[model samples]
Target chain A: MSAPARSTGVWTAAAGSAAAEPRETASAPPRRRSARRRRRWTGLAFAALPLAVYAVVVLAPLVQSIQYSFFKWDGVSAATWVGFDNYVTFVTDPILRSTFGHVLVLICFFALLPIVLGLFSAALLTRAKQPGMAVYRWIFFLPQVMTTVVIALVFKRIYAPDGPLNQALRAIGLDSLARTWLGDFTWALPALGLIGTWVTFGFCMVLFISGTSAIAPELYEAARMDGAGPFREFFAVTLPGLRGQLAVALTLTMTAALRTFDLVWITTHGGPGTSTLTPAVALYKAAFQNPQVGLAAAIGVVMAVLCLVVALVITRVSERD
Target chain B: MATTVAVVAGLALTMSACAPGGGGGSESSAQPSSISTDIASAGTVTLKMTDFWGSAEGKWIDQAIADFQKKYPNVTIDRTSEDWGQLNSTLNLQLQDDAGPDIASANNGWQSLGTLAKGGLVVNLDSYAKAYGWDSKVPTTIIRQNKFTTDLKTMGSGSWFATPMARTSLIGLYYNADKLKKLGIEPPKTLDELEVDAAKAKTAGEIPFQYGSLDGSTSALLGVQAVLADKNKLNDYVYDVPTVKASDVGMKEAVETVKKWADAGYFPKDFAGIDYQTAVANFVKGQGVFRWEYTGSLGLSTEQQKHFGYVQLPQSGGKTVGVGAAPGAMVISAKSKHPEVAAAFLDYLMSPAAGQTAVDLGLVPALSPDVKVPETSLSLTGESAAAKTLDSDDGYVPYFDWSSPTMLDTLGQNLQLVFAGKMDSGKFTAAVDADRDAFLAGQA
Candidate 1:
């Protein structure tokens, strides 16, 4: 920060000194200023379309959603101003409060677990060119490409009591271990979390692998010369090198975790007794099914704030170097 | 960027709250005096109809539309159909617009019907009802289900906002004939007899009930409510009677009975993991002795229908009451171009001919449940018989989900907790009561 500030200060001082030198530049400054003005107009013209589109599609709705959080609306009716009552309800309501805990648990699965496994796999797979590496890459990245709905449906069946998961447990003579994965209250959230891990670990792995490729090979060579094993070598070079990628992956996965709706909706619908409910599912039910559009807007605002905080923290921490 | 967003939001929020359907206020846009019931006055009229019956459930509606079209050649019906949840979720937005449907098939609950009615997006149907003599023709029980107060605070005694289009849903018990016969059990005549038979089935190494609770066990709760709920008492709760509590109408007893059945291992193993469709499919494949479902053998062949017997869960008092409603009820949108033609179409829906068409399509007719039709399948006969009995007795309790906007989610989630032994019936009752009280308080 200090280096950049000092450099900017120097540049400004240089520019000021140049401007102050009035030896021959009476008409020259105006020409340069006009040229700069014309360039600025061109830049504005180029940006006008996207700016308009973004304002209409994103900004207007965002403003409306914030406005909606302050009222009591049944979508079609005259909205009643309730001030911060919806936000208060979101905080005090037990069912709504429980959803935040579910998202936190999901973040462990969707973000942390994936990053660990992703880094592990990237270390192993990207260390050397192995036969069938392309096939492995394809297999790992498969979940990232499939639609969340389809993935959820497939996982729903797989986690069924008689699905292949339980059947496999039974086949291994672990009959007592077999239970309905998605239906059990103790297991439902974790079962959903495992699906999150399955879908995101591959993307994280691909991200880390790409990040590793950008690292200087000399760092690895030096670590090897120092008699460092694979574990030490990874810590010494690969780990530090992938910080930016880790931040990117963390931001994306954490937000995905926070905004999880369709997967939970298609699978459990926050069911077997609200064991798997998330904020997004609650928002949808409030807005669509319960017709509490105001409460839904409040949930949306809170979720957006949470996601923004997570992203900002990750970005700031990653940029600390 | 942040300052700009704050300014925009502050300016908008100060100007107006975002009333989702925009600024008509909560009064009926089309007054009773302005609405004409003269179908002949509107010549070459095209009425856009939006409905939620696009699947096999739509056959009866399609037949009704055809019959109505034949009666009025001058009116052309332009229809759009989608799934039930999809349609209801978007119906408010559609109805608020000028080019929205003339008539829309709406769900019975507060979220769809009550909300739309309160917003004045749909026309008040009292004028049309009197014009078409619906009070005398449509059964009071069915009509009561569609009525909501002009304020939309309570239902069952108010001006009509929607009318059932010949079809309604009924909850009842379905048994496998061969399985019952093999177990040496006659059709259970009472709840005790049913429980005894279930015990026998359990001892005989057969799944007594083909139960799937992934749907929050609401269907099973409906079946339980059929056995347990007192029609009048349940009415007090569902119709927003202020003094009544949820536990007053045997709700806890119903929950206890379901929990007892769960403890007895009467339901299929891992039943919570199975969905309704899969459980129905399993029942058809002879996996369970009995199944609780709505009044249709949807996937059954005629032979299969004959082998399966449909009956209401037997009540101790020899009265039939169940979780049922006019699921395909239609209302005229305030934005409709042809209000009278729409009213006529709705009136035609309550006609005996339309009821006959509903029966022919294996749908339970709401208006005239006793309309005679050739009984090619025994299950249809049983459904009609059950519907007729309920109608005569005024025995239909609105599916309790209509009690509160969030009641569906509350019942669904908490019922699973009760079943899973994570929560008791008392807590479940409290959760439900909280939702109801909150909604009722909002009304006040």
Candidate 2:
């Protein structure tokens, strides 16, 4: 509160001085701001603690992971430096290579589908001023609040051989089409991805809703007045206004997709023989499950680099006016 | 600004006090000479133990702990459980920081023990074992399973790193007895017979075989076992041979067998993504005639027990060889503060009472001349039957998954690719050969 008061006083004083400067130009005192400079540095140092802690806790370990990538250690033994062997192995290893492909597939479900469906839902919600809009928002966000373990278990049951999905298919006289949804190689990745889409789209929708609410309603009204239809209005007004929120959503969702381990571990443990194996799952198996810590660290570094590059690219694109 | 600095410094100190590693130096010095003795003297020693088994099974462990405390009123046991997924990641961090519980359950495998042993983080139990008579009773086979060479010293050979709480075979076929009866099919005794039974079940409007490969390794293990059985060469393939060659007659035969099974539509198309629990649920719901699962699956609740029958998996060509890793064993960590206490706990668990308790919970006791397990109990009966089969059959072989350190994932995944028709039989054999070669080279 004191800081705000001081800032307002400073602003008022600067304005007054600026107005009076021309009349008494030669008589203006030189502004020796050493004390103010000291204050600013002190304030900055106080502000830097959280960031410093974050860097130490998160960024330091991340950088160490990159360093560890070039070594071979089972976490308990002496580390052996092997140059780019780990990276080479990751790129060339058939299982890891296939796992990377699976991650790409998940990106479609976790990143692309969620954003598209979220935008669509957000658009519809914007036009509908209903009495139970809050309730709908809560319902959509329910999955987000529930633990991934619960979600995976519930979804596993829903996709079971005799579960509702197959039952429904049988009822519709589509017995031939009824197969174990999560168990089939062809359906496993897509089925898991669909769950990812369902769990995440609501978060994206909420982001869009908040972002759209901030945009002036007059712009949408003017677009309609100018003969722009709903679709055109969305593209011209809503989409552009949601660029920042879209960037955030995409970054978060994409990170979630790339780092996906929990739901897969809980539901299928990356099974039916590696059909659902992602980089994170592979990293875990290599590190903790198999004690190939060095290889796991290497995989982790690669993943971090990929995430960083993607994030930077998205941020640059989103920020481009 | 100076006041602000002072305030910040105060906050920093307060936060530092809350940090996890802050108390390490002082706590290390202040800890009691013996954790168990300290508990006894204090009239209540709260020892924390963490495990992967959830609340459902944890309740049994809790009951055991309660019984332990009742016998020794001074010792209070506080038990906590975490999911295996979280535990795997957290264990190393917790161990490194000395924040892990005094006692923890660990899988008696190289992957779990090797790193910790190498790091000199666990307690050595040789002295404790000798003193407690654990050296005599616990079988050499059980001891060998947990042994590891760490820093030129074998940390877990006769020494303990973790206690064997329960034993379960990794490979078995669980069937729905009611469904089998209705379909008028006996449990298959060979690969050909199994195929016929599966076909019959499918024709009778039931899923024949319920196996999930989504984890890739489970599918590969099943496929590998089937192939090994067919060749009547399961043991020779895994341990006796120095190197596995793709062109080797037995190896090629196994790969072909797996491919043939996959092509026959005996396995569900979506079997790859289903988890172990779901696979069991499918068996329970009569969705499948047989489920390839761990022997421990028989221990599932009454609801799960309703439709299932347990049988040893059919061998290739009726050779009747059993294969799987030796059951999980207990080892003592070298760094444990109370190695004697840990050893005592292990000895107690191996006693007739505790062994029976484990058997009652659907775990096989490691010691032979097993205590009389109640036939009515779901946990005891099936495992008892399997144990009886193993005793009678000379062809029982340990699981191939446990043969090589890295083969678990590699073989499992490759087998999946083969089953999915992504890899031909030749390529699948070649891949496994290469993997085995690489693993052997690394071991050397």
Name the candidate that leads on DockQ: 1
Residue A131 lDDT (model 1): 98
**Per-candidate DockQ vs. reference:** 0.49, 0.28
lDDT (tens digit, per residue) of candidate 2 on A1-321: 011122233334333432535253465455746765697799889989987986776656654565666666666545666667889999998878888899899999999999999999999999778798888888898898888889988988888877888999999999998887766778888999999999998899988999899999999989999999889999999999998888878777777787888878776667666778888878877876676666887787777667666666777788797
Tens digit of lDDT per residue, candidate 1, span B184-253? 9998877898899999999999999998888575777768876887778788788888788878887888
Candidate 2 lDDT? 0.64
Q: What is the lDDT of residue A19 in candidate 1?
A: 52
Q: What is the lDDT of residue B168 in candidate 1?
A: 67
TM-score for all predictions?
0.92, 0.72
